[model samples]
Target: MRTQIAIVGGGPAGLLLSQLLNRVGISTVVLERKSRDYVLSRIRAGVLEWGTVELLRTAGVGERMDHEGMPHDGCYLAHDGRMFRVDFRDACGRQVMVYGQTEMTRDLYAAQDAMGATIIHDAEEVALHELDGEAPFVTWTHDGKPFRLDCDFVAGCDGFHGVSRPSIPKEVRREFEKVYPFGWLGVLSHTPPLADELIYASHERGFALASMRNPNLSRYYIQVPLTDHVEDWSDDAFWQELKRRLPEEVAERLVTGPSIEKSIAPLRSFVSEPMRWGKLFLCGDAAHIVPPTGAKGLNLAVSDVHYLAEALKLFYSSGDGSALDGYSEQALSRVWKAMRFSWWMTTLMHRFTEHNAYERRMQDTELAFLECSAAAQAVMAENYTGLPY
Candidate 1:
């Protein structure tokens, strides 16, 4: 098989890239290790930066999102038994869309199918060859048969654990990472959300976030020890812990229900530098990862796709490879800023066991300052709504 670009992941990043490129008459083939059902079954973050929302519209997959997704002007921060709102529009003249990653991926798949784009699911043992040479190709197996795909370039959107990142030689790739000591115990419930917008709470016990996918589906999380398991907490216990961390007033109106999905996710900030090597370019989790506190994971991936797709488009149209050469620098500049923001937010909201009393006081003071100072709030709003592309 032959294609202009071989995308080594069928997630949102790869599919969106294919969607954008296909619209401009570029050919792409997406390779996925899992079945389509498995990909769509995974639950993920719901908040979308305004830039991401616009990009989806540009890719022709935003119709459903704009129709069903919630748009919020701001979110709340809870501390010391009280909560304060940060008006994104008032501070930054922008807003974020509350749309689940799963739903967005589904929309992208539908669009891809309608356009007859190539997406091969359940591809096994995918490998890249001659990535540093003029000719690059990918190989994988399916149904006891070997296959090879020759392409001009490869997109490593296969995520953190995928083969794309590891394909880069160790000597050429530099990585930075910080693994948090705690994890988030998240629950998805079939009930109305606690509030109109998301609420991030920092309490004496731990951290909690009250979020929603839609009016009838609520998503909530509470910080937990890394050693904790999903089976450790019952639905009632999870709600009680969440209520304790939230502000009294907000918790009063909370609607409790049976949890449909539950899991524990450890927090981490990871980045593999030089997102491009020869004909291979990394995108999304394959290149960088941010703690979820800033809601930047899926949004960050979209930005990477934007950079890569445009670079490829420019190269093909104008015969100018400059954008392709500069893809890493441009994407990394924004990636680092998001890394800092997510790290700062995680530190501010999470209760670290290693922190002393003085450090805890500083966290409280920082949140307090952010609540009262317009300048600080503006900075938060700018970062939260997303830094420019």
Candidate 2:
């Protein structure tokens, strides 16, 4: 098969990129290792930066989101038994949409189908060929048969463990990583949210987040040790532990129920530099990762798509590669800023093994400063809503 662009993953990044490109008369194919059902079943971050919402709309997939997604103007930060709200709209003239990533993926898939874009799922052993040269292609297996895809450029949206990033020669690629000492034990349930907007609590015990997919479905997470497993905590136990970490008032009114889904996710901050290496470019988790504390995961993917999609359009239209040439640098500039914000939020909210009393006090002090100072609140709001594309 021949196409203008070959996308290595069918997740939100790859699908969104394909949808965006196809809308502009570009032909692209998406190859996914997992089944479509498997991809949609994966639950991910729900917070959406305003820019991400706009991108989804531009991709022709935002109708459902705009209809069903809740708009959040502020979120609460709880520290030392009191909670303060950061008004994002007031501070930065922007608000985020609380739409689950799973829903976003479904919308993208529907849009792709409407556009008649080619998306091949259950593709296995995908490999890149001659990405360093002018001509590049992708090879993979589907239903025990081998297939080859010829394309002008390859996009590696396959994620952290996917083959696309590793295809770049190790001698040419440099990675920076930091694994946090804790993980997030998340619980999903069909219960009313504990509050109108999300609450991020920083307590002496640990950190806890109260979020929602809709008014009837809620998602919550509490910091845990790396050693904890899903079997180690029951729904009742998880609720008890979570309550202990939240403020008394919020806890008193909090609703508890059986967890529909439960999992533990390790926190980490990682980045792979030079997102573009020759004809192959990396997007989203293929190139970087951030802790969930900052809700930057999917937003980062959208931003990368913004840069790469625009660059590819320019390349195909005017035969100019300047934007394409600057994809890596342009994407990395925003990537590093987001990485810093996620790291800072993780450090301020979670309890670390090495945190001394001084460090704990420092966290509380920072929260206090954030509550009292409009400048600090604006800074947080700006970063939380998103930086820019």
Candidate 3:
């Protein structure tokens, strides 16, 4: 098989890239190691930066999102048994959209299918060849049959554990990572949200986040030890712990119900520098990862896709390879900013076991400063709403 670009993952990053490029008459093929059902079944964060919301609209998959997704001007921060709101619009003249990653992926898939775009699911043992040469190709197996796809370029949107990142020779790739000592015990419930907007709580016990996917669906999380397991907490136990961490007033109005989904996700900040190597370009989790505190994982990937898609479009249209040559530097600049923001948020909200009393007081003082200072709030709003593309 032959295509202009071979996308090595069918997740939102790859599908959105394909959607954007296809609209401009570029050809792409997406390969996935799992079935379509498996991809859509995975639950993920819903908060969308204003820029990400706009990009989805540009990709022609935002109709459903704009119709069903919740748009919030700002979110709440809880500390010392009290909560304060940061008005993103008032401070930065922007807002974020609350739309689940699963829903966006579904929309992308629907758009891709309607356009007859190529997406091959259940592709195993995917490998890249000649990535440093003029000719690049991808190979994988399906039903015990070998297949090869020749393409002008390869997009490594296959995520952190996928083959794309490892394909880059260790001698050329540089990686930086920080694994947090804690994880988030998240639950999805069929109930109304505790508040109109998301609330991030920093309590004496731990960190908690009150979020929602829609009016009837609420998502909540509480910080937990890394050694904890999903089976360790029952639905009642989870809700009880969450309520303890939330503000008394906010917890009073909280509605509890059977959890539809539950899981524990460890926090981490990772980045593999130089997102591009020869004909291969990395996007999303394949290039960088941020803790969920800043809601940057999916949004960061979308930004990478935006850069690579535009670069490829320019290369094909104007015969200008300069943008392609600069893709890594351009994306990394924004990636590092997001990394800093996520790290800062994670440090501020979580109760780190390693932090001494002085360090804890510092965290408390920082949040207190952000609560009262307009300048600090504006900075938070700007970073939370997202930096410019």
Candidate 4:
């Protein structure tokens, strides 16, 4: 099989890139090792930047999102039983939508299928070719038959573990990483949210977050030791900890159904410089990863692919590789900014024993400023809701 562009990984980045390219009359093929159902059902980051929502709407895939996703104008930061609302709407005149990443994938998948784009799922032994050359393609097996895809260019939206980034020469690539001592133990349940907006609580007990997937389902997370195991948390124990962490008033309304799912994700911030190498380009988690505190993971993925789609369009039409050449540097500028924001959020809200008396007092001072000063609140609001893509 041959196409103009061969996309590796059918996650949001690859799928969205294929969709955007297809819309502009560029032919592409997407390869994935998992089934379409699996891709559509993977739960991930939900908060959508206002610009991201607009892009999806313009791309003809935002109808269901607009219908089912709740608009959050702001979020609450709670500390020592006090609530400080950061009004994103007031700060930037834009509101974020609380919709699950699964829903976004479904929308994109449906749109791509309807447009007759090529998306191969359940393909095994997927391998990349020509990583060091001007031409690159994917080789895989589908239904026990060997197949090869030859394309003009390759896009590695395959994520951090995929072959895309590893293809870059190690000597030339620079990697920056920081692993945190904490992780988030998240639970999904069939309960309505305790509040309309997300609540980020920095309690003496721990850090807790109250978020909603929709009106009928809620998602919550608590900070835990990075080495903690999921089996260590019992349902009853989870609820008791939640109650201790949340504000008194909010805790009263909190209700959890049997946990439909639970897992712990380690917190880390990593960035790989130079997102492009030759005709191959990397986007999304393949190039950078941010801790979940800022809710920037999926949004950054969307932003990277959006810029990529635009660049690819110009490349395919005019043969001017300027955009592709600058993809890494351009995307990294925004990626690093988000990395800083997520790191700041994680450190400011979570407790650390190593913190001295002065360091401990500084957190309280920062929270007080965020609560009382309009300027401080505005800064939080802007970063929380997101910076313009």
Candidate 5:
């Protein structure tokens, strides 16, 4: 098989890249290890930044989102039993949309199919080769049949476990990692939202986030030990701990029904330097992962694919590789900026016992200052809602 580009994963990154390319009359193939349903239903990021929503709307996938998605002007910062809101619309002329990753995946999947793009699901044992040769090779097995795929370029949209990064020469690869002591125990329930906008609460007990997947479905998360098991946390146990962190005034309103599903995700910051090597490029979690506090993961993935699609379009149109050549550095500039924002938000809400009493007191002061100062609110609003993509 041959294509202009071979996308290694069918997640949002891969699908979006394929869609953009197809728009410009480029052919690509997407290979996914998971089945189509699994990829569309995966529970993941639910917040869509304004920039991402705009991009999706331009790509013709935002009609459903614009109709079904809930818009939030800002989020609430609840600490010490007090709540203050930072109005993103007022500060930055931007607002976030409460659209789940699954929905975006489904939309893109439909768009890709409508455009007549090739998507191979349940692919197994995929491998990349000839990265240094004139043409790159992608090989995979599906249903016990092995096949070889050749393409001009390969995109490793696969997640962290994908082999794209590992294919890099050991001597040329550089890695940066930071693992947190905490993880988020997330839950999805069929309950009306307790709040109109998401509430990010910081308490002595732990960190809690209240968000919505839709008008009738709510998605929430609470910080827990990294080693905690999802099975070990019973329904009663989940609510008991959640009540401690969430504001008491809003606790009663947060309806806890028989949970539809639950899971625990370890918090970590991971980055693989140089998102591109030879004929292969990485996007989304494949290149870097940001903690979920800032809701940047899904948005970052869209941005990466946006830049990548534009670069490829230019490459084919003008026969210049300048845009592709600068892909890594250009993407890194925004990646690092988002990294800082996510890290700051994580530390501000999460408990760190390593801090001395004086440091703790200083943190409290900073929070209080941020709550009242317009300048500080503007900073959070711009980063939270997103900057121009």
Candidate 6:
């Protein structure tokens, strides 16, 4: 089989890329290792940066999101038993939408079907060949039968564990990573959210975030040691711990319910340099990973798609490869800025014992500044709402 681009994953990043290309008369085939139902069942982050929402609308998949997603103009920050709001719209003229990733993925799938794009589920042993050459191809097996797919380019959107990054020779690849000492123990339940907007709290005990998918579906997370497991916390225990970290007033109104989903994700800042390797351009988690503090992972991946899609479209139209040649350096500039922001937010909100007295004092001073200084709040608002693509 032949296509213009062969996408190696069917997650939001891969599917959205294919959707954008389809609008411009580009043909793509998406290969997924799991069934469609399995992919939609995964509970992931719900925060959507404004830029991401715009991208979806341009791709013709934002109709449902516009109707169902909640919009937040600002969020609250709690420190020293006090909560203060940072108005993103006033500070940056932008606001984010609270649309769950699962829902967004569903919309993309519906858009793909409406457009008649090809997506193969249950694909196994997906492999990329000759990425450094002009005529690259992908191979995979379905129901024990092998097939070959040839394309002019390949998008390695299969995520962190996928083969796209490993395909780059170790001699040419450089990786940078910092693993934090803690993880986020997240719980989802069908209870009313405690606040109108998200609340990120930092107390002597640790960090806790009160978020939501909608009015009734609440998503909350608390910091835990790296060794902690999901089985360690029962629903009652999680609710109690979360209430303890919140302000007294907010805790008084908090609603608790049985958790429908529970999981733990380690915090880390990682980046693989040179996002492009010949014809294989890595996007999203494949190229870098940021802690969830900044809500940048999914948004970053879509940004990569935006840039890569623009470059590829121009190249195919005018027969110029300069944009493709500069894709790595251009994308890295934005990636590093986001990495710094995520690391900064994580440090400010999370409890780190490794900090000395001076470092701890500095953290307290920084939070205090953010509370009173309009400039600091503006910076946070711009970063949280997202930087220019």
Give per-model TM-scores.
Answer: 0.99, 0.99, 0.99, 0.97, 0.98, 0.99
- lDDT score, residue 51, model 4? 76
For model 6 the TM-score comes to 0.99
lDDT, candidate 3, equals: 0.96
Sorted by lDDT (best first), the order is: 1, 3, 2, 6, 5, 4
Model 1 pairs whose backbones collide: none
Task: Point out where model 6 deviates above 4 Å.
Answer: none
Candidate 2 TM-score, true structure as reference: 0.99
Q: Mind giving the per-residue lDDT tens digits that candidate 1 earns over 1-389?
A: 99999999999999999999999999999999999999999999999999999999999999999999999999999999999999999999999999999999999999999999999999999999999999999999999899999999999999999999999999999999999999999999999999999999999899999999999999999999999999999999999999899999989889999999999999999999899999999999999989999999999999999999999999999999999999999999999999999999999999989999999999999999999999999999999999999
Q: How many backbone clashes does candidate 5 have?
A: 0
Residue 50 lDDT (model 6): 98
lDDT of 5: 0.89
State model 6's lDDT: 0.94
lDDT against the true structure, per candidate, is 0.97, 0.95, 0.96, 0.88, 0.89, 0.94
TM-score of 4: 0.97
User: Per-residue alpha-carbon lDDT of model 6 for 1-389, expressed as tens digits?
Assistant: 99999998899999999999999998999999999999999888799999999999999999999999999999999988889999999999999999999999999999999999999999999999999998999999999999999999999999899989999989889999999999999999999999999999998889999999998899999999999999999999999999999999899899999999999999999999888898999999989999999999999999999999999999989999999999998889899999999999999998998988888788888999999999999999999999999
Cα RMSDs, all models: 0.5, 0.6, 0.6, 1.2, 1.1, 0.8
As for candidate 3, its clashing pairs are none
Enumerate residue pairs that collide in model 2.
Answer: none
Query: What local lDDT score does residue 121 receive in model 4, on the 0 to 100 scale?
Result: 94
The 10-residue segment of model 3 with minimum total lDDT is 160-169
**Model 5, residue 189: C-alpha shift (Å):** 0.3
Q: Distance (Å) between predicted and true CA of 311, model 3?
A: 0.3
Instruction: Please identify which of the two predictions, 4 or 6, would achieve the higher lDDT against the true structure.
Output: 6
